[model samples]
Target: MPSISHKIQPCLWFDSQAEQAARYYTGIFPGSSISSVSLYTEAGQEIHGRPPGSVMVVAFELAGCRFTALNGGPIFKFTEAVSLIINCDNQDEIDYYWHHLGEGGDPAAQQCGWLKDKYGLSWQIVPAVISDMMRDTESGKAQRVMTALLRMRKIDFAELQRAYRG
Candidate 1:
């Protein structure tokens, strides 16, 4: 019997900039690269009537997760309802992603460990200790932390920690 791999790959739909986006992602993340790029062609013109040399699909990896970007011609657009969440160990990790993803991304306030990037993609830049902080049984403490988060565009971990203690 042969063993099957259970890796789940996410496919991203883009208008015409799939390759550029893939390159940007590869540059931002370590241990990432373009796995493959495919083009579309039509049978009558060339199979499905797609123009030759048009980008069909791009397979890439970021932080070891596989994602495919399809140049689907803008039929669908991304929304903030679904986003990639990053759990940061410290302020430095948070800052790096915040600067890059938020540079052109819109900022939305979510109670604890959530933000929306410009591409309408959601991201959660959460400190590793957030779970421990939220574990506090005291409702008041949790409320205070939530309050602090509501006031932030890019979350400040130190401030959240202070709120957690108060």
Candidate 2:
């Protein structure tokens, strides 16, 4: 186990892919890694109903944000109501994240830069400027940008810029 500093972090529930999910997430983001892993022992066999030494939880960090993935069974699942938002710097950044995160994900779940990864985790990949553009309602540029955004699955930063300019 590595030394932990974060007092609180998002805990993600998984049926059996806690370690795999942690590795996958850490691989995608720079300055990220798995810090620790705890395993179920014979002490909890009656309740956990698993072989001893099975993975129970995995602690990881993505771009400095800490998260915990638990093999807590399939009683719960990820829904679109909760999502991770990645605010990108440019079109290239957007494209890079979209490609890496959306790969092997459900195609039908993508809309307006939002996607569901293979793990059924929802994510919104968008240019940071989109927030500024969408907030500029005083000039009505926000409406134009929103209209352009509605038509996109993987947001095109260039297109949003054009809509904002108009």
Candidate 3:
């Protein structure tokens, strides 16, 4: 309905799954949408190797952040160095995102709420309170939370709460 006002937008590189990834992400987050799409023309066919009228880039938004999914012919891949973080208010939210985002993902790559999704995108599903606890270093809550967090893949919210209290 309105224009994307964000100055900086993340452009994800996909081989040929740009549209698929855009749809998958839009379906998961509320108030998200695929705002626009651009098709490749024959002008750059020799270099890009994509056919005319094929999907080239899909612009979308998640959590109010605009993103561009580019069918860049597998030139780049997602790594753990950078990830999208999803902050949840509670355990159910964590579980909900963890299940959905981690589907068909690399199980071994999952650690401390960080997961690599089916599309090779990395995501961090964490509870909001964990950050607060992790920053409460004066009370030793940060240490306890870090200890508990390091042992978890999908974060245990209740366990973190217990750690925070101790």
Candidate 4:
């Protein structure tokens, strides 16, 4: 198979924590690292107001997925509408991501395996089984799973499995 180069990458906007967020994310996931860092230049100082030589953008990879974190000032902030989904194979993976990502996060924002990380980036730490369980359209198993899923903050794979069986 030919190696596919990714054309589109998600760019995360941060007030000034692009480098910090990149470092945090690289530390959390395996096979992740900061590939490059671009500093702000004097040419755009008036509009950007950021000091020259300060971090402007950080290109990083988390678990093989490329991402760009931009220190674009406080013009915009993260919302829950867009979230990065982490599909885990089992409960252990779920717990690990939940614990790590939820640190310094808004507790109220955590629902149905969805959470806002410290940088205000939304994430869904879900189990792989949830997708299989949700695919059962013939019976009301999917509905049951959905009901069970709606009640929880962090996803419980066992509960979803039980809901699927019912």
TM-scores for the candidates:
0.82, 0.95, 0.95, 0.95
Error of 2 at 139 (Å): 1.2
**lDDT digits (tens) for residues 1-166 of candidate 2:** 3566888789999999999989998999988999889999999688888678889999888988999999988889999999999999998889888999899999999999999999999999999877788898989899999999999999998999999999
Off by over 4 Å in 1: 1-6, 43-50, 107-118
Mark the regions of model 2 whose C-alpha exceeds 4 Å error after superposition: 1-4
Those runs of model 3 whose alpha carbons end farther than 4 Å from true positions after fitting are 1-4
CA lDDT for candidate 1: 0.76
| Model 3 Cα lDDT, one tens digit per residue, 1-166 | 7666887889999999999999999999989999899999999689999999999999998988999999999779999999999999999999999999999989999999999999989999999876688888998999999999999999999999999999
On residues 92-127, what C-alpha lDDT tens digit does candidate 4 reach at each position?
Answer: 999999999999999999999999998899999999
Off by over 4 Å in 4: 1-4
Q: What is the C-alpha RMSD of each candidate to the true structure, in Å?
A: 3.5, 1.4, 1.5, 2.8
Scanning candidate 1 in windows of ten residues, the lowest lDDT window is 41-50
Name the better of 2 and 3 by lDDT: 3
Clashing pairs in 2: none
Between prediction 1 and prediction 4, the one with superior TM-score is: 4
What TM-score does model 3 achieve against the real structure?
A: 0.95
How does each model score on lDDT? 0.76, 0.92, 0.93, 0.93
